[model samples]
Target: MFKNVLSENIWGRVVSEKEPVFEEINKIVESNSKLISKLNNEYHDHDSTIKLLSEITGQKVDDSVGVNLPLYSDFGKHLSIGKSVFINSNVMFTDLGGITLEDHVLIGPRVNLLSVNHPTNPEQRRGLIVSPITIKKNAWIGAAATVLPGVTIGENAIVGANAVVTKDVPANTVVTGSPAKVVKTI
Candidate 1:
């Protein structure tokens, strides 16, 4: 269903909303949204939730993963969750550009992992910029943090609560504040 525009090379490209490809993408997003609603509202048990999530992503989600619902994703097909990953409630993943959470990753409540943005130029603001976001193994993203497009949180790193991460975080470090900076290295 998503063959027209779901390519690895889609990263960093700006796609106009008026394009036919955008319509195709929108359809997929809408369909996924319905499934997400079921995940948030209908399914309460862990097994049932994971089964629905697997259907949403078009992949087999591992049973080792745990997600507290009310989880949201704009484009579900691009999200990849590894074994033993735990995602808290109220988390939003705008994963159109792709998002991968490696094994042992912990996502706290209300966190936003956004891999899609718009052009800064007002005239081209309707055009979408696609980028990937990766959370490496053992990384813990604290409550209410926002990880922006193209950012990677390295293995064993900790993102402090409410931080806005705009750049890559190195491994074994603790980062805090807006445009999150490494405050300590482990």
Candidate 2:
């Protein structure tokens, strides 16, 4: 499967015996919003903002500006977004591996779509798990919520606010709680 192959190829090179630093790959990977004050300017259009971000992260971003607010992702190099997706403020997407979001998705505030995680084995703690986060078409990830690695959020699913999703959310259902459960099926 491409997922496994992709993960193994990319994340295998991410971690080291010491902690991995973004600066180590700064030239290879893009992102310096903290260093460049202008990139953070609100005046930059969403498309332009994302474009600059792509240059910084070395990722490919398709169809930015689904909403007026600026979208931020470390995976601008690895993320491939779809059309008409309205994402709200303060979304932190760390796509060190890859993050693919399908069309017509709605994202709320402070939503974290992270793809990189460390292994449980302390002996092999240097190893990395780069699982791409896939939000299928028409999915809604709620506010201040966290979607863990390798979990596929199904099409048209509605994840409630502040939910911590540790598993795959089936399509057309509503999920909530710390380790989100199926609250309702829509």
Candidate 3:
């Protein structure tokens, strides 16, 4: 059985949950988890929390980026945030592949951006696939929305509350419901 799965864009390399690469990724997760714990528990300084997030993610998060506390992520290094982004509380980012939020993006409370998934085949169920999720500039994701792997929300698009986004959303569109269908174009 083929244990290695080829990821399209996340890493552009062969990946397998059973391989050493997954182990390394797990270590990153573990370390970041501790830092995120501190970030959630200690809430005196917002700047310090952002600094810790930047350190864990290895990205220069702009000062203008406002992320409310109690955010969670499986891997922080794979996340990249653009300028003037507002992420509300209780957001979960599973960025094993990558999750990019462009400038002026607004993510509402309890939103989930996930980028890692397993294959359907039980024999290869342990195999993991990583895909990048991109929310373009000025997009707004409503409260409790879940953006799945490889999804790209286009510029100025709006995902309605509690929507489960499984595919790419067009630019200047409003999407709602499970699987996220475009209801109107802005």
Candidate that would win on TM-score: 1
Q: Give the alpha carbon lDDT tens digit for every residue of 72-180 in model 3.
A: 9878888888889999999999987788899999999999999888777788787777788999999999999999988999999999999999999999999999978
Q: What's the lDDT for residue 6 in model 1?
A: 62
Task: List candidate 2 segments past 4 Å from native.
Answer: 1-8, 11-26, 30-38, 53-64, 68-70
lDDT of 1 by residue, 84-170 (tens): 999999999998888989899999999999989999989889989988899999999999999999999999999999999999999
Pick the winner on lDDT between candidates 2 and 3.
3
How do all models score by TM-score? 0.95, 0.77, 0.92
lDDT of 2 by residue, 1-186 (tens): 112212224554546545444334343333444523455555777677667655644544555436444456653456656767777877877766677778888889889998888878788676666777889999999988999887899999999999999999999999999999998999
User: What is the lDDT ranking, best to worst?
Assistant: 1, 3, 2
The C-alpha stretches of model 3 lying farther than 4 A from their native spots are 1-14
Model 1: pairs clashing at backbone N, Cα or C within 3 Å: none
User: Is 1 or 3 the stronger prediction by TM-score?
Assistant: 1
**lDDT-better candidate, 1 vs 3:** 1
Preferred candidate (TM-score higher): 2 or 3: 3
If candidate 3 were superposed on the true structure by all CA atoms, what would the RMSD be?
4.7
